[model samples]
Target: MQLPVETTDSINKISELRNTNLQNILKKEIDKNALWKGLVAKNLMAIGIVDLTDMSNIKYAGINDNLMMYAASLPKIAVLLASMDAIENGELEDTKEIRKDMRLMISKSNNAATTRMIDRVGYEKIEAVLRAPKHKLYDEETGGGLWVGKRYGGGGDTNREPLKNLSHAATTMQVCSFYYQLVMGNLISDERSKEMLEIMKDPALHHKFVNTLDKIAPRAKIYRKSGSWRNYHSDSALVWGPNRRYIIVALIDNDFGEKIIRDLVVPLERVMKKARNLEKETKI
Candidate 1:
């Protein structure tokens, strides 16, 4: 099934959806979970969730959503966006090799493919695009959002974001904004968003969020990107379901970050489900 088409007001209304009800619901869930609550207290874990079941009245909430952290390969997504921007602007050639590498880079999280794309686009291009007025994806004022300072493969360092100075860094809210914009067809353009979504569909690696999602919602269409490096683990997904739709993004720094990410799926889903139910009751 295809994603919902963008409406005339999507771009304007797509800013951040901060609803009090949803905020309380999400915060309560996290507080009840011992592991999540503790990590959140230490500012080691950040989660951003958006309930898209009612696009007209979208709801969003997060805990430590603006806390930037080392996100490993998750920020390859910034490279993907920059590539699309370059392609659309005619700054980069649209060749078969580029297309193939884009797919491998995102789907498989292949370091070699990612580094090649980064080389082609360059850190300057990525930085400009991220800080562009329309996107503000890596705004320093907002705690520095999605940023790709270093290449995926072994490299010295390109341009680490000024705020956190992490090579590959992301804040939950910023990553969430990326997915939200993509789904809204505001990333570059509608057609470009579709192309990027195609590349992200059916992630190659099946750990973290995808690991548990594979079993629980087998039929749902999931477009996701995830990463893991030593103690840092991160995952983000745009889950499109028959009855439920939402975006979930997370960044973690801990020895058990992998398990923390995997375990996050259920509670996060519950938050979405509970929010949906509450929305129904209000309507009734």
Candidate 2:
């Protein structure tokens, strides 16, 4: 999403402090609580959050934020962006079939649909977009952000992300950026990014973050993608609330990652709400 000139300037004001108020609150809860302590001990958890109320006044908070983990289905969002990019560039058709595939691939976590979309988008092309100077959603310096090197449900070993050599991979910082940029209209053209986000709306499979967030903010609107395989689970979303809009990305690499991700919802909900109230709350 294309952020306004001043909004872009605000994104530059990001602060990185582990002991900031929001960080302190979240770290205290995740560290002291049994629900999240085990994952932290295993070095299997990472998270990033961006307050998007003013775009320019946004602040970021994170823990293990740069750690890369097997992203599960979260990386499918990369393909979603790439597909829209192709459509915008006139390299692909914007057909009903393509739209359905994109929607299902995200909303339902459809592996087959993701494979089709990825094949059309091409792994190299997706990388190019992520690594592009403009987006930098995935950066070598940060050990990479979002990547899909293989088709979902296995196969295409030749395409796994180079940083971790995993079929799918992500970093908390990057996924947060993905949603942040998507919200800023920087992932693709403003119009195409809106269409892409619309495809992710009203998610059909609600199990991870969305499920837990629902427990607190029952009516919150979320556009998210989630994935779980073996012990790893990852979820990233742009969440909408009565007072603000924000992005939260969590990457976990343990058997209990989903539970840990879910457990974070309450504490995060509190911190996020308080943080936004500190700013001038802007309802999306």
Give the number of the best model, judged by TM-score: 1
Candidate 1 — what's its lDDT?
0.87
lDDT of 2 at 226: 87
TM-score of 2: 0.87
TM-score of 1: 0.96
Give per-residue CA lDDT, model 2, range 1-284, as digits (tens). Answer: 22221223223312332226667666766777774677766677887877666543566788888788888888889889888888889988999999999998999989999899888888888888878877777777877778887888666645776677877888888787777766666666667667877887779977888877777666667889888889888888888866547778888887777777887776776776676654445453
Q: Which pairs, if any, clash in model 2?
A: 1-184, 1-185, 1-186, 2-184, 2-185, 10-56, 149-159
Q: What CA root-mean-square deviation does each model show from the true structure?
A: 1.5, 4.1
Worst 10 residues of 1 by lDDT: 7-16
Candidate 2 C-alpha error for residue 192, in Å: 1.3
Q: lDDT: which candidate is best?
A: 1
Model 1 C-alpha lDDT per residue in residues 176-221, reported as the tens digit of each score:
8888888888889888988998899889899999898898888888
Candidate 1's C-alpha runs over 4 A off are: 4-10, 13-15
